[model samples]
Target: MPGIAVRTAAVLLVTVGDGTSFPTAAHLASYAGLAPTTKSSGTSIHGEHAPRGGNRQLKRAMFLSAFAALHDPASHTYYDHCRTRGKTHTQALLRLARQRINVLFAMLRDGTFYEPRTPRLT
Candidate 1:
């Protein structure tokens, strides 16, 4: 109302986009610039970098959401999986954001809100 980061607003906006039960998690992630960037040249090359273009506020919101994902067993497990697979903190967070996007997509498509399903520990 008074003052809030644009990222926060973006997340909320995406969550409520169109009111058709679709929030465009994928769109939100891309908008936030949380997606990875790749650069290659004749010789020199950069593997990946934080995305170059997107809404900074959305990026900040997604990053902030990463912390919350860390504490959730389901989300944390996925987050750990990304890290274990050789992703850095930033990379892992991006992966988590992507995962979150998928979840949101599914929810929107199915008309369901998040209800994390945790796998049984073996």
Candidate 2:
């Protein structure tokens, strides 16, 4: 929601179409091609990789939103955390997009608005 503007929101609404098509956020992420897929065969299992399928428009919207969200402190922190965890720049952005999809799903499901989390002082 941080980076989602009029055009982005329009694209998302047009692409997702009522949100009933996806049962869960995971389903939405998969549809948008943000969910990583695991490739395996016998004992020689391949690692998770970005899938080459799904709605390209939705994927592009999510990806661009994630990139634009980097300006938000929370989003920037998450991106940095992903980078520290050894995720590539693109991978981190994809992960962020997936994370945002979960939030979007919850918002759509509950008809709620975005509320930024406040950092707890410890």
The whole-model lDDT of each prediction reads: 0.63, 0.90
Off by over 4 Å in 1: 1-11, 14-16, 19-28, 38-48, 119-122
lDDT of 1 by residue, 2-27 (tens): 12246665665664463354256556
* TM-score (all chains, Cα) for each model: 0.64, 0.90
Model 2 regions more than 4 Å off: 41-44, 118-122
Q: Give the local distance difference test score of model 2.
A: 0.90
Model 2 vs truth, CA RMSD: 2.6
Query: Against the correct fold, how does model 1 do in TM-score?
Result: 0.64
Clashing pairs in 2: none
TM-score of 2: 0.90
> Global lDDT for candidate 1?
0.63
